[model samples]
Target: MGPEGGGDALLRLEGVSKRYRRSGLLALDDVSIWVGAGERVGLMGPSGSGKSTLACIAAGLLSPNAGHVRFDGVERSGGGRLPRGRSAAVRRAWLGMQMVFQDPEASFIPTMRLGDAVFEGARYLPRFKGADKDRLVREALEAVELPGSYAERFPYELSGGECQRAAIARAVIGRPKLLLCDEATSALDVTVQAKVMALLGRVHRELGTAFLFIGHNPALVGGFCDRIYRIGGGRITEELEACERP
Candidate 1:
Protein backbone atom coordinates (compact mmCIF):
# COMPACT_ATOMS: atom_id res chain seq x y z
CA MET A 1 0.00 0.00 0.00
CA GLY A 2 1.09 3.58 -0.60
CA PRO A 3 1.22 6.49 1.82
CA GLU A 4 -2.25 7.59 2.98
CA GLY A 5 -2.12 11.35 2.56
CA GLY A 6 -2.29 11.24 -1.26
CA GLY A 7 0.78 12.34 -3.24
CA ASP A 8 2.76 10.00 -5.50
CA ALA A 9 4.97 8.11 -3.11
CA LEU A 10 8.60 7.46 -4.00
CA LEU A 11 9.23 4.67 -1.47
CA ARG A 12 7.07 2.25 0.47
CA LEU A 13 7.76 -0.53 2.96
CA GLU A 14 4.89 -2.91 3.63
CA GLY A 15 4.75 -5.49 6.40
CA VAL A 16 8.54 -5.53 6.47
CA SER A 17 10.17 -7.72 9.08
CA LYS A 18 13.74 -8.73 9.91
CA ARG A 19 15.37 -10.87 12.56
CA TYR A 20 18.92 -11.78 13.47
CA ARG A 21 19.70 -15.49 13.90
CA ARG A 22 22.54 -15.47 16.38
CA SER A 23 20.23 -14.69 19.27
CA GLY A 24 16.99 -15.07 17.37
CA LEU A 25 16.20 -11.47 18.17
CA LEU A 26 13.69 -9.55 16.10
CA ALA A 27 14.94 -6.21 14.94
CA LEU A 28 11.88 -5.03 13.07
CA ASP A 29 8.40 -6.50 13.10
CA ASP A 30 5.69 -5.83 10.58
CA VAL A 31 7.00 -2.37 9.84
CA SER A 32 5.18 -0.29 7.27
CA ILE A 33 6.13 3.17 6.12
CA TRP A 34 6.07 5.29 3.00
CA VAL A 35 7.86 8.41 1.87
CA GLY A 36 6.15 10.71 -0.61
CA ALA A 37 8.09 12.44 -3.34
CA GLY A 38 10.01 15.44 -1.94
CA GLU A 39 8.82 14.70 1.61
CA ARG A 40 11.19 14.66 4.54
CA VAL A 41 10.66 12.12 7.34
CA GLY A 42 12.72 11.47 10.44
CA LEU A 43 13.27 8.26 12.39
CA MET A 44 14.24 8.55 16.03
CA GLY A 45 15.05 5.97 18.70
CA PRO A 46 17.34 4.92 21.50
CA SER A 47 20.42 2.87 20.68
CA GLY A 48 19.77 -0.75 19.63
CA SER A 49 16.26 0.14 18.53
CA GLY A 50 16.96 -1.07 14.96
CA LYS A 51 17.22 2.42 13.49
CA SER A 52 20.31 1.61 11.44
CA THR A 53 18.95 -1.79 10.49
CA LEU A 54 15.85 -0.13 9.10
CA ALA A 55 18.08 2.21 7.12
CA CYS A 56 20.11 -0.70 5.74
CA ILE A 57 16.99 -2.52 4.58
CA ALA A 58 15.54 0.66 3.07
CA ALA A 59 18.74 1.35 1.13
CA GLY A 60 18.74 -2.15 -0.48
CA LEU A 61 21.86 -3.13 1.44
CA LEU A 62 20.02 -5.83 3.41
CA SER A 63 17.13 -8.08 2.52
CA PRO A 64 14.19 -8.19 4.88
CA ASN A 65 13.12 -11.59 6.15
CA ALA A 66 9.61 -10.93 4.89
CA GLY A 67 7.47 -8.34 3.08
CA HIS A 68 8.18 -5.78 0.37
CA VAL A 69 9.91 -2.50 -0.44
CA ARG A 70 8.64 -0.49 -3.36
CA PHE A 71 10.19 2.42 -5.13
CA ASP A 72 7.91 4.43 -7.41
CA GLY A 73 5.29 1.71 -7.03
CA VAL A 74 7.58 -1.05 -8.37
CA GLU A 75 9.20 -3.51 -5.99
CA ARG A 76 12.77 -2.63 -5.07
CA SER A 77 15.84 -4.86 -4.75
CA GLY A 78 17.32 -6.56 -1.65
CA GLY A 79 14.11 -6.87 0.40
CA GLY A 80 12.43 -9.01 -2.22
CA ARG A 81 13.02 -11.09 -5.36
CA LEU A 82 13.57 -9.51 -8.75
CA PRO A 83 12.72 -10.75 -12.26
CA ARG A 84 15.46 -12.79 -13.96
CA GLY A 85 18.49 -10.71 -14.96
CA ARG A 86 16.68 -7.70 -13.62
CA SER A 87 18.89 -7.35 -10.59
CA ALA A 88 21.03 -4.91 -12.53
CA ALA A 89 17.96 -2.91 -13.36
CA VAL A 90 17.07 -2.81 -9.71
CA ARG A 91 20.56 -1.62 -8.88
CA ARG A 92 20.32 1.05 -11.54
CA ALA A 93 17.11 2.26 -9.97
CA TRP A 94 18.92 2.40 -6.62
CA LEU A 95 21.62 4.53 -8.18
CA GLY A 96 19.18 7.39 -7.83
CA MET A 97 19.17 6.78 -4.05
CA GLN A 98 22.10 7.38 -1.73
CA MET A 99 22.93 6.66 1.94
CA VAL A 100 25.06 8.86 4.14
CA PHE A 101 26.58 7.17 7.17
CA GLN A 102 27.01 8.32 10.75
CA ASP A 103 30.73 8.31 10.47
CA PRO A 104 31.95 9.91 7.27
CA GLU A 105 35.52 8.97 8.03
CA ALA A 106 34.67 5.30 7.71
CA SER A 107 32.90 5.71 4.36
CA PHE A 108 35.86 7.12 2.41
CA ILE A 109 39.08 5.49 1.24
CA PRO A 110 42.10 7.09 2.83
CA THR A 111 44.12 6.65 -0.34
CA MET A 112 41.60 8.32 -2.67
CA ARG A 113 41.63 12.05 -3.27
CA LEU A 114 38.50 13.91 -2.14
CA GLY A 115 37.56 14.82 -5.72
CA ASP A 116 37.85 11.25 -6.98
CA ALA A 117 35.99 9.99 -3.96
CA VAL A 118 33.07 12.33 -4.62
CA PHE A 119 32.86 11.38 -8.29
CA GLU A 120 33.65 7.67 -8.04
CA GLY A 121 30.13 6.23 -8.38
CA ALA A 122 29.23 8.68 -11.17
CA ARG A 123 31.93 7.45 -13.56
CA TYR A 124 29.33 5.54 -15.60
CA LEU A 125 28.08 8.73 -17.21
CA PRO A 126 29.70 9.21 -20.61
CA ARG A 127 29.91 12.97 -20.19
CA PHE A 128 31.43 12.68 -16.71
CA LYS A 129 35.05 12.71 -17.85
CA GLY A 130 37.93 15.23 -18.00
CA ALA A 131 36.93 18.86 -17.53
CA ASP A 132 33.30 17.98 -16.96
CA LYS A 133 34.14 15.81 -13.99
CA ASP A 134 36.39 18.52 -12.60
CA ARG A 135 33.62 21.04 -12.97
CA LEU A 136 31.18 18.77 -11.16
CA VAL A 137 33.68 18.10 -8.39
CA ARG A 138 34.12 21.82 -7.87
CA GLU A 139 30.38 22.46 -8.01
CA ALA A 140 29.64 19.70 -5.50
CA LEU A 141 32.21 21.00 -3.08
CA GLU A 142 30.80 24.48 -3.33
CA ALA A 143 27.30 23.15 -2.91
CA VAL A 144 28.35 21.84 0.48
CA GLU A 145 29.93 25.24 1.28
CA LEU A 146 33.44 23.90 0.93
CA PRO A 147 36.14 25.89 -0.84
CA GLY A 148 37.23 24.69 -4.28
CA SER A 149 40.83 24.26 -3.12
CA TYR A 150 39.72 21.63 -0.61
CA ALA A 151 39.08 19.14 -3.40
CA GLU A 152 42.76 18.32 -3.72
CA ARG A 153 43.13 17.60 -0.02
CA PHE A 154 42.69 14.06 1.26
CA PRO A 155 40.08 13.02 3.83
CA TYR A 156 42.59 13.02 6.67
CA GLU A 157 43.39 16.66 6.07
CA LEU A 158 39.78 17.73 6.75
CA SER A 159 38.07 18.45 10.06
CA GLY A 160 35.16 16.26 11.16
CA GLY A 161 32.63 18.74 9.78
CA GLU A 162 34.45 18.99 6.45
CA CYS A 163 34.56 15.23 6.14
CA GLN A 164 30.85 14.97 6.74
CA ARG A 165 30.17 17.66 4.16
CA ALA A 166 32.34 15.81 1.67
CA ALA A 167 30.26 12.68 2.21
CA ILE A 168 27.13 14.76 1.61
CA ALA A 169 28.70 16.20 -1.55
CA ARG A 170 29.17 12.67 -2.86
CA ALA A 171 25.50 11.85 -2.27
CA VAL A 172 24.18 15.09 -3.76
CA ILE A 173 26.35 14.89 -6.90
CA GLY A 174 24.54 11.69 -7.79
CA ARG A 175 21.37 13.80 -7.88
CA PRO A 176 19.60 11.13 -5.89
CA LYS A 177 15.84 11.17 -5.66
CA LEU A 178 15.96 9.78 -2.12
CA LEU A 179 18.68 10.37 0.45
CA LEU A 180 18.88 8.11 3.52
CA CYS A 181 20.87 9.97 6.11
CA ASP A 182 21.92 7.72 9.02
CA GLU A 183 23.16 10.10 11.70
CA ALA A 184 24.91 12.15 9.03
CA THR A 185 25.20 15.18 11.27
CA SER A 186 25.83 13.46 14.60
CA ALA A 187 29.58 13.90 14.70
CA LEU A 188 29.66 17.63 14.16
CA ASP A 189 29.35 20.37 16.76
CA VAL A 190 26.04 22.20 17.18
CA THR A 191 26.96 25.08 14.89
CA VAL A 192 28.37 22.91 12.12
CA GLN A 193 25.47 20.52 12.41
CA ALA A 194 23.07 23.39 11.87
CA LYS A 195 24.98 24.40 8.76
CA VAL A 196 24.82 20.88 7.35
CA MET A 197 21.12 20.67 8.09
CA ALA A 198 20.57 23.97 6.33
CA LEU A 199 22.51 22.69 3.36
CA LEU A 200 20.31 19.60 3.27
CA GLY A 201 17.19 21.75 3.41
CA ARG A 202 18.43 23.79 0.46
CA VAL A 203 19.27 20.68 -1.55
CA HIS A 204 15.89 19.10 -0.89
CA ARG A 205 14.04 22.27 -1.84
CA GLU A 206 16.10 22.81 -4.98
CA LEU A 207 16.23 19.22 -6.25
CA GLY A 208 12.88 17.99 -4.97
CA THR A 209 14.59 15.06 -3.27
CA ALA A 210 12.88 13.11 -0.51
CA PHE A 211 14.91 12.62 2.66
CA LEU A 212 14.60 9.80 5.21
CA PHE A 213 16.55 11.40 8.01
CA ILE A 214 17.62 9.13 10.90
CA GLY A 215 18.77 10.70 14.12
CA HIS A 216 18.34 10.54 17.90
CA ASN A 217 17.90 14.25 18.49
CA PRO A 218 14.24 15.17 18.85
CA ALA A 219 14.83 18.89 18.54
CA LEU A 220 16.94 18.59 15.44
CA VAL A 221 14.62 16.17 13.67
CA GLY A 222 11.61 18.21 14.77
CA GLY A 223 12.93 21.26 13.03
CA PHE A 224 13.77 19.57 9.71
CA CYS A 225 11.22 16.83 9.17
CA ASP A 226 7.64 16.76 7.99
CA ARG A 227 6.87 13.82 10.27
CA ILE A 228 8.60 11.85 13.00
CA TYR A 229 8.46 8.12 13.71
CA ARG A 230 9.79 6.75 16.95
CA ILE A 231 11.20 3.22 16.94
CA GLY A 232 11.35 1.19 20.10
CA GLY A 233 11.06 -2.47 21.16
CA GLY A 234 11.46 -3.52 17.53
CA ARG A 235 8.44 -1.54 16.41
CA ILE A 236 7.35 1.97 15.60
CA THR A 237 5.83 3.23 18.82
CA GLU A 238 4.56 6.58 17.68
CA GLU A 239 4.10 8.81 14.67
CA LEU A 240 3.78 12.55 15.06
CA GLU A 241 3.31 15.49 12.78
CA ALA A 242 6.48 17.61 12.94
CA CYS A 243 4.71 20.80 13.84
CA GLU A 244 2.67 19.15 16.58
CA ARG A 245 5.59 17.72 18.48
CA PRO A 246 6.30 19.27 21.91
Candidate 2:
Protein backbone atom coordinates (compact mmCIF):
# COMPACT_ATOMS: atom_id res chain seq x y z
CA MET A 1 0.00 0.00 0.00
CA GLY A 2 1.25 3.49 -0.80
CA PRO A 3 1.24 6.53 1.52
CA GLU A 4 -0.92 9.62 1.18
CA GLY A 5 0.11 12.30 -1.36
CA GLY A 6 1.55 9.52 -3.52
CA GLY A 7 4.44 8.26 -1.45
CA ASP A 8 5.73 4.89 -0.14
CA ALA A 9 4.02 5.03 3.26
CA LEU A 10 1.67 2.22 4.14
CA LEU A 11 -0.13 4.42 6.65
CA ARG A 12 -0.28 8.21 6.85
CA LEU A 13 -1.91 10.62 9.28
CA GLU A 14 -2.19 14.26 8.21
CA GLY A 15 -3.20 17.18 10.39
CA VAL A 16 -5.34 14.88 12.49
CA SER A 17 -7.02 16.37 15.51
CA LYS A 18 -9.39 15.09 18.20
CA ARG A 19 -10.90 16.69 21.26
CA TYR A 20 -13.19 15.55 24.04
CA ARG A 21 -15.75 17.51 26.08
CA ARG A 22 -17.07 21.02 25.47
CA SER A 23 -13.95 22.60 26.93
CA GLY A 24 -11.99 21.19 23.99
CA LEU A 25 -9.31 19.19 25.78
CA LEU A 26 -7.37 17.90 22.82
CA ALA A 27 -6.40 14.26 22.78
CA LEU A 28 -4.58 14.71 19.52
CA ASP A 29 -3.55 18.02 18.05
CA ASP A 30 -2.93 18.10 14.32
CA VAL A 31 -0.62 15.10 14.51
CA SER A 32 0.99 14.00 11.27
CA ILE A 33 3.14 10.98 10.52
CA TRP A 34 3.76 8.21 8.00
CA VAL A 35 4.71 4.56 8.39
CA GLY A 36 6.51 2.96 5.48
CA ALA A 37 5.86 -0.60 4.39
CA GLY A 38 7.68 -3.19 6.51
CA GLU A 39 8.80 -0.47 8.87
CA ARG A 40 8.42 -0.97 12.64
CA VAL A 41 7.73 2.27 14.51
CA GLY A 42 7.36 2.39 18.26
CA LEU A 43 5.06 4.85 20.03
CA MET A 44 6.08 5.82 23.56
CA GLY A 45 4.21 7.98 26.04
CA PRO A 46 3.04 8.05 29.63
CA SER A 47 -0.46 6.97 30.59
CA GLY A 48 -3.28 9.30 29.46
CA SER A 49 -0.88 10.85 26.96
CA GLY A 50 -3.06 10.14 23.89
CA LYS A 51 -0.86 7.42 22.43
CA SER A 52 -3.78 5.00 22.46
CA THR A 53 -6.07 7.66 21.07
CA LEU A 54 -3.76 8.14 18.12
CA ALA A 55 -3.55 4.38 17.68
CA CYS A 56 -7.33 4.11 17.72
CA ILE A 57 -7.54 6.72 14.98
CA ALA A 58 -4.88 4.95 12.95
CA ALA A 59 -6.79 1.66 13.23
CA GLY A 60 -9.98 3.34 11.91
CA LEU A 61 -11.81 2.79 15.22
CA LEU A 62 -12.12 6.45 16.24
CA SER A 63 -12.79 9.35 13.94
CA PRO A 64 -10.79 12.55 14.15
CA ASN A 65 -12.59 15.86 14.44
CA ALA A 66 -10.30 17.19 11.70
CA GLY A 67 -7.67 16.06 9.19
CA HIS A 68 -7.27 12.90 7.13
CA VAL A 69 -6.05 9.34 7.50
CA ARG A 70 -4.83 7.44 4.48
CA PHE A 71 -3.99 3.77 4.36
CA ASP A 72 -2.19 2.68 1.24
CA GLY A 73 -3.45 5.86 -0.41
CA VAL A 74 -7.07 5.08 0.47
CA GLU A 75 -8.69 7.67 2.71
CA ARG A 76 -10.14 6.32 5.99
CA SER A 77 -12.67 8.09 8.17
CA GLY A 78 -11.99 8.63 11.83
CA GLY A 79 -15.63 7.80 12.49
CA GLY A 80 -16.44 4.10 12.65
CA ARG A 81 -18.89 4.10 9.78
CA LEU A 82 -18.03 1.26 7.43
CA PRO A 83 -19.94 1.22 4.16
CA ARG A 84 -23.04 -0.97 4.09
CA GLY A 85 -22.84 -4.41 2.44
CA ARG A 86 -19.29 -3.46 1.52
CA SER A 87 -18.02 -3.60 5.09
CA ALA A 88 -17.36 -7.30 4.92
CA ALA A 89 -15.85 -6.96 1.47
CA VAL A 90 -13.50 -4.21 2.55
CA ARG A 91 -12.43 -6.10 5.67
CA ARG A 92 -11.80 -9.31 3.75
CA ALA A 93 -9.96 -7.63 0.90
CA TRP A 94 -7.84 -5.51 3.19
CA LEU A 95 -6.66 -8.35 5.36
CA GLY A 96 -3.43 -6.44 5.79
CA MET A 97 -4.47 -4.46 8.88
CA GLN A 98 -4.83 -6.20 12.24
CA MET A 99 -4.60 -5.08 15.86
CA VAL A 100 -3.37 -6.99 18.93
CA PHE A 101 -4.26 -5.16 22.08
CA GLN A 102 -2.42 -5.00 25.42
CA ASP A 103 -4.87 -7.20 27.25
CA PRO A 104 -5.31 -10.50 25.47
CA GLU A 105 -7.53 -11.89 28.23
CA ALA A 106 -10.12 -9.22 27.60
CA SER A 107 -10.03 -9.89 23.87
CA PHE A 108 -10.55 -13.65 23.90
CA ILE A 109 -13.84 -15.42 24.46
CA PRO A 110 -13.52 -17.39 27.65
CA THR A 111 -16.10 -19.93 26.61
CA MET A 112 -14.73 -20.68 23.15
CA ARG A 113 -12.21 -23.37 22.27
CA LEU A 114 -8.72 -22.10 21.52
CA GLY A 115 -8.81 -23.26 17.90
CA ASP A 116 -12.20 -21.72 17.32
CA ALA A 117 -11.05 -18.50 18.96
CA VAL A 118 -7.95 -18.28 16.79
CA PHE A 119 -9.82 -19.05 13.57
CA GLU A 120 -12.96 -17.08 14.45
CA GLY A 121 -12.32 -14.38 11.87
CA ALA A 122 -11.48 -16.89 9.17
CA ARG A 123 -15.10 -17.99 9.09
CA TYR A 124 -15.90 -14.75 7.30
CA LEU A 125 -13.94 -15.82 4.23
CA PRO A 126 -15.91 -18.29 2.13
CA ARG A 127 -12.81 -19.79 0.58
CA PHE A 128 -11.78 -21.18 3.96
CA LYS A 129 -14.30 -23.81 4.94
CA GLY A 130 -14.28 -27.03 6.92
CA ALA A 131 -10.94 -28.67 6.13
CA ASP A 132 -9.36 -25.45 4.93
CA LYS A 133 -10.29 -23.66 8.13
CA ASP A 134 -9.02 -26.59 10.16
CA ARG A 135 -5.71 -26.54 8.34
CA LEU A 136 -5.33 -22.82 8.81
CA VAL A 137 -6.15 -23.18 12.49
CA ARG A 138 -3.47 -25.79 12.91
CA GLU A 139 -0.94 -23.69 11.05
CA ALA A 140 -1.69 -20.64 13.15
CA LEU A 141 -1.39 -22.60 16.36
CA GLU A 142 1.93 -24.05 15.26
CA ALA A 143 3.15 -20.67 14.20
CA VAL A 144 2.74 -19.47 17.76
CA GLU A 145 4.54 -22.54 19.02
CA LEU A 146 1.44 -23.93 20.68
CA PRO A 147 0.62 -27.62 20.55
CA GLY A 148 -2.15 -28.82 18.25
CA SER A 149 -3.95 -30.29 21.27
CA TYR A 150 -4.36 -26.76 22.54
CA ALA A 151 -7.23 -26.38 20.12
CA GLU A 152 -9.55 -28.14 22.53
CA ARG A 153 -8.59 -26.02 25.51
CA PHE A 154 -10.49 -22.98 26.77
CA PRO A 155 -8.98 -19.59 27.58
CA TYR A 156 -8.98 -20.35 31.30
CA GLU A 157 -6.90 -23.46 30.72
CA LEU A 158 -3.92 -21.75 29.12
CA SER A 159 -1.30 -19.63 30.84
CA GLY A 160 -1.31 -15.88 30.25
CA GLY A 161 1.53 -16.10 27.74
CA GLU A 162 -0.10 -18.93 25.84
CA CYS A 163 -3.36 -17.08 25.67
CA GLN A 164 -1.58 -14.01 24.33
CA ARG A 165 0.16 -16.09 21.71
CA ALA A 166 -3.19 -17.49 20.67
CA ALA A 167 -4.48 -13.96 20.21
CA ILE A 168 -1.45 -13.07 18.06
CA ALA A 169 -1.91 -16.22 15.96
CA ARG A 170 -5.48 -15.21 15.29
CA ALA A 171 -4.36 -11.77 14.13
CA VAL A 172 -1.61 -13.10 11.83
CA ILE A 173 -3.54 -16.05 10.40
CA GLY A 174 -5.01 -13.77 7.76
CA ARG A 175 -1.56 -12.41 6.82
CA PRO A 176 -2.18 -8.70 7.40
CA LYS A 177 0.14 -6.11 5.86
CA LEU A 178 0.01 -3.78 8.87
CA LEU A 179 -0.04 -5.04 12.46
CA LEU A 180 -0.95 -2.55 15.19
CA CYS A 181 0.43 -3.79 18.48
CA ASP A 182 -0.81 -1.66 21.37
CA GLU A 183 1.37 -2.65 24.33
CA ALA A 184 0.83 -6.25 23.28
CA THR A 185 3.61 -7.68 25.39
CA SER A 186 3.08 -5.50 28.46
CA ALA A 187 1.17 -8.07 30.44
CA LEU A 188 3.51 -10.99 30.04
CA ASP A 189 6.43 -12.09 32.19
CA VAL A 190 9.89 -11.06 31.07
CA THR A 191 10.70 -14.43 29.49
CA VAL A 192 7.32 -14.72 27.80
CA GLN A 193 7.51 -11.15 26.62
CA ALA A 194 10.87 -11.83 25.02
CA LYS A 195 9.48 -14.90 23.26
CA VAL A 196 6.50 -12.98 21.93
CA MET A 197 8.68 -10.12 20.74
CA ALA A 198 11.00 -12.55 18.98
CA LEU A 199 8.04 -14.22 17.32
CA LEU A 200 6.70 -10.84 16.19
CA GLY A 201 10.09 -9.82 14.74
CA ARG A 202 10.33 -13.10 12.85
CA VAL A 203 6.85 -12.65 11.47
CA HIS A 204 7.66 -9.12 10.35
CA ARG A 205 10.79 -10.31 8.59
CA GLU A 206 9.22 -13.38 7.01
CA LEU A 207 5.95 -11.79 5.87
CA GLY A 208 7.11 -8.19 5.43
CA THR A 209 4.42 -6.98 7.77
CA ALA A 210 4.64 -3.35 8.88
CA PHE A 211 4.35 -3.00 12.66
CA LEU A 212 3.12 -0.03 14.69
CA PHE A 213 4.44 -1.10 18.07
CA ILE A 214 2.93 1.09 20.81
CA GLY A 215 4.45 1.01 24.29
CA HIS A 216 6.09 3.08 27.03
CA ASN A 217 9.25 1.05 27.45
CA PRO A 218 12.25 2.39 25.56
CA ALA A 219 14.18 -0.83 26.07
CA LEU A 220 11.42 -2.90 24.49
CA VAL A 221 11.14 -0.60 21.50
CA GLY A 222 14.90 -0.36 21.16
CA GLY A 223 15.10 -4.12 20.84
CA PHE A 224 12.53 -4.45 18.03
CA CYS A 225 11.68 -1.23 16.22
CA ASP A 226 13.72 0.63 13.60
CA ARG A 227 12.39 4.04 14.68
CA ILE A 228 10.64 5.45 17.73
CA TYR A 229 8.16 8.26 18.24
CA ARG A 230 7.59 9.68 21.69
CA ILE A 231 4.11 11.21 22.04
CA GLY A 232 3.17 13.70 24.74
CA GLY A 233 1.11 16.86 25.19
CA GLY A 234 -1.18 15.85 22.31
CA ARG A 235 1.70 15.64 19.81
CA ILE A 236 4.86 13.77 18.94
CA THR A 237 7.72 15.21 21.00
CA GLU A 238 10.63 13.15 19.74
CA GLU A 239 11.43 11.00 16.73
CA LEU A 240 14.53 8.89 17.32
CA GLU A 241 16.45 6.41 15.22
CA ALA A 242 16.75 3.19 17.19
CA CYS A 243 20.31 2.63 15.98
CA GLU A 244 21.29 5.93 17.56
CA ARG A 245 19.82 5.15 21.00
CA PRO A 246 22.48 4.98 23.72
TM-scores, each model vs. reference? 0.90, 0.89
Instruction: Show model 2 residue runs off by greater than 4 Å.
Output: 1-6, 22-24, 84-93, 126-131, 244-246
Per-residue alpha-carbon lDDT of model 1 for 110-221, expressed as tens digits?
9889998999757654445554788889999999999978889899999999999999999989788899999999888999998889889898889988989999998999
The whole-model lDDT of each prediction reads 0.84, 0.82
**lDDT of candidate 2 over 1-246, digit per residue (tens):** 223432768888888888986777899998887788888888889988888888888888888999888776466643744445555556565456788999887888888988888887566665665557677888899988998789889988988899889998989887778899999999899999999998998888789998899998889987788788889988988887786322
- C-alpha-based local distance difference test score of model 2: 0.82
RMSD of 2: 2.9
lDDT value for model 1: 0.84
Q: Any residue pairs clashing in model 1, and if so which?
A: none
Candidate 1 has its poorest 10 consecutive residues by lDDT at: 122-131
Give me the candidate number with maximum TM-score. 1
Each candidate structure's count of clashing pairs: 0, 4
